[model samples]
Target: MGRKLLSLLLFASLATATPAAAAPTAAPQPPTELVTGLSLPWATSFLPDGQSALMTERNSFRVSRVTLDGTRTTVGTVPNSVTTNGEGGLMGIAVSPTWNGTSDQAVYLFHTSTDGGQTQNRVVRMDFDGTTLSNRTVIVSGIRSNTFHNGGQLKFGPDGFLYAGTGDAQDTSTSQNDSSLNGKILRFTTSGQPAPGNPFGTLVYSKGHRNPQGLAWDSAGRMWSAELGDTQFDELNLIVSGHNYGWPICQGSCSTPGMDNPKRTWTTAEASPSSLAIVDDTAYVAALRGQRLWRVELNGENAGATQAYFTNTFGRLRSIVQVPGASAIWISTSNTNGDKLLRSVIQ
Candidate 1:
């Protein structure tokens, strides 16, 4: 689609967007470990219940159920997931909030598969019967992939649409090219088609993303994403359908006419953020290279004061999940032998 067409689509979509988020009322809490000793876990998704969560391992291709007591049960592995040869493999997992152990058991996974010399990433759906993941169903496919910038973030939006965050796959042109699926946040139904009422009449929900790895929705149902930049700035963006984020042409604070400014941005060294979770009202971003968790206070869709926690204490935090019904969250470490899970305990 042309730039003007996209802008018009976005304007139409924005006409229905709820007013900016209400004044957030979240207080920061410290995090603690709940489990330890796992291989390259990529993401953690909480079950509808408060305790157990489905956790995905990158190279292992395994999904395990972990509880507050640190006990874990093997859910299953995605058979065709490529090993993490160059940051590509079984990456993100999203469990449906409505999944019942009986008939509706559904879990979605994003993995990279070998496509000759190049790699292709896809999101597949599997049935989780509280024990094993069966009935593999490939939902979305043919997303071109490279070694780096394979954005693998997935979350179910409040409107019950499955949202997948994709990278530009190291090709900057695709970010601005609406025809390409790379560097975009896509919305689809559980059946894997474009969600009804999506802007641009396609799966592409928002475009012009560089390497978006984290996605979460706030209480007001507004979507937010954490994206990595080339060299200068990393962004925390409030995602709006059909809006342009200005990846290659404009990094941070670009005065480009139609490009959207991020709610917040940090230097690359401080926030190679991956996987975000909203707790209370704050958006907690797990910083991979920064080795910390960032707390961004939200006020009407914009960010206020920010804080960093667990700096360098846990090597390369990968995913953070808000403990359901609690003010604390679960933090996972990406350190080689040091990789472990921690939970917060009020002091």
Candidate 2:
């Protein structure tokens, strides 16, 4: 063969042998408004049916059922709930995975309440008969509450147990205290007992969290959390049973002997990440102060580069949940002035 022909053939062979770099994940399409005029909405939990979701309004203490078709109905108001006027009030809600609206109609809520003139955070269970909420039962209590750092996001893990993310309640000491429920991610059974094989013998699943607000499980069942740092950085942590995520010790990444560093970190100004949802291989985080939706590509246990969407467009994004049985996500705005719940198509 001629020299030019041989060189061209060698170049083509090398190109075919090299694997192509993966294409970057596309940003979510512009969101469509699903429900409007919400008041500081916080968390969203889709019912088993996937037709609607239960949402909480922070200051209103009202629980509402929001359908995908833009209809909103007040299911019931959580009695005895109080807001700290900052981050407290009716915060997180999770529907029982086994809920049938008949035999097992259990819905869980986390809220701040006043007890004997002291404010505290607690998780309660109620019966939802598909119309109204009733039978309020306090499952877990005595979590410290403050005006600022009251972490309240509840989710059912892939293991069928409930998990709670709590803040340090403005007291940094609680983050390292295993006996304290504040500043920790808690795992428990439906009936309010510590889950089997919990890292500690108590409800504490992991310790040393400053203000963890978001929890999600990747396709491999590994848990991930989004946390608000004090001033320097925000964190996306790979949560492990009993691992201490450096909090007062380290805000984002650290070299402490026994502490776990975050998989990714963003400046506090870039991400006050609240709720997290994993769709396919991407982890979507809703930012409160950042006023955007962050798409973090997940590569196994590690998080890749991030992309922000809807910055300053929808105001402060708070709650985000992957639409059940669909390739979409429902994210809510937290701006107190006529907030809205939006649905965005995940590419």
Candidate 3:
């Protein structure tokens, strides 16, 4: 899509978004270890049956099928994945919401790889048949990647489209560039084309992000994101299509017009939030530096005060997703030293 045309379409979509409605909130119980002896597990997406979930290991590039009862099986390693030696590697997996054992068995993944030996990030599709993965096909590719800030988080929104958060690839310029895919939240079709009705004619749903890693939707279908900041602050944002989140221009909150401020902000020491999950209208953020789970209640398009859970008890919390059929959540450790998956009940 041409930059000028894309810009016009993006702004057009912006004016069409409606305000979000709030949902209920709850407190989560202390987490208990479910699966141990894992590597750097980065993301988790449960199968439609709710009996098991598919998880990704960053440095190892291994995909594992983990049962609700803690049984873990190595499904397959993603092909051509490479670690950036900092943060880039195999990351983000989303099981198709309509996946069935027989036919509609699509699953998606986001990872760092080399295309013609040039480092980039990609979104790929594979088929899972309750046992193994096959038919690997690159759905979306050519997003710039670096050692760190290669934003890698994928989730299927309630609208039935795949959403991916891409980092600025350490190039601050890319976040503000409408033509670049980096530093943006992108919407895509099952076949990897830009999703229809996207604000931009391209895949970009929103731009000007630093390193957005967490993506989730509330009961009202409002999109929210958790982003890692450069030095001072981290952010939780209520995502609106075609919005521009201040990045290099503004870290947390600024008075700048045309740049949206975060709904909530935290000091880097308190929250290097890597992943987010929404349950009962409450936002649960997995903190990497603070080593805890931070909860923020959703109040319509705004957020409430923050609370911390299991502080310093878990080492470098990474992924957190609500259990498919229960009022519980599954979390993963990212320390890479015999990490584990945990489950927590919400009350």
User: What is the C-alpha lDDT profile of model 2 across 106-129, one tens digit per residue?
Assistant: 999999997567779999999999
lDDT of 1 at 223: 89
Between candidates 2 and 3, the TM-score winner: 2
* Candidate 3 per-residue C-alpha lDDT over 88-126 given as tens digits, one digit per residue, 9 for 90 to 100: 999999999999967888989999987678778999998
Clashing pairs in 3: 151-167
In model 1, residue pairs whose N, Cα or C atoms come closer than 3 Å (at least 3 residues apart or on different chains), thus clashing, are 32-342, 32-343, 33-342, 33-343, 34-341, 34-342, 167-183
The positional error of residue 107 in candidate 1, measured at the CA in angstroms, is 0.4
Error of 1 at 133 (Å): 1.2
Q: Residues 130-244, candidate 1, lDDT per residue (tens digit)?
A: 8888888888887877888889888888898899989999899999988888999999998889998888888899999999998998888888999998899999999999999
Report clash pairs, candidate 2.
Answer: none
What is the alpha-carbon RMSD of candidate 3 to the true structure?
A: 13.0
Error of 2 at 327 (Å): 0.9
Mind sharing the TM-score for model 3? 0.92
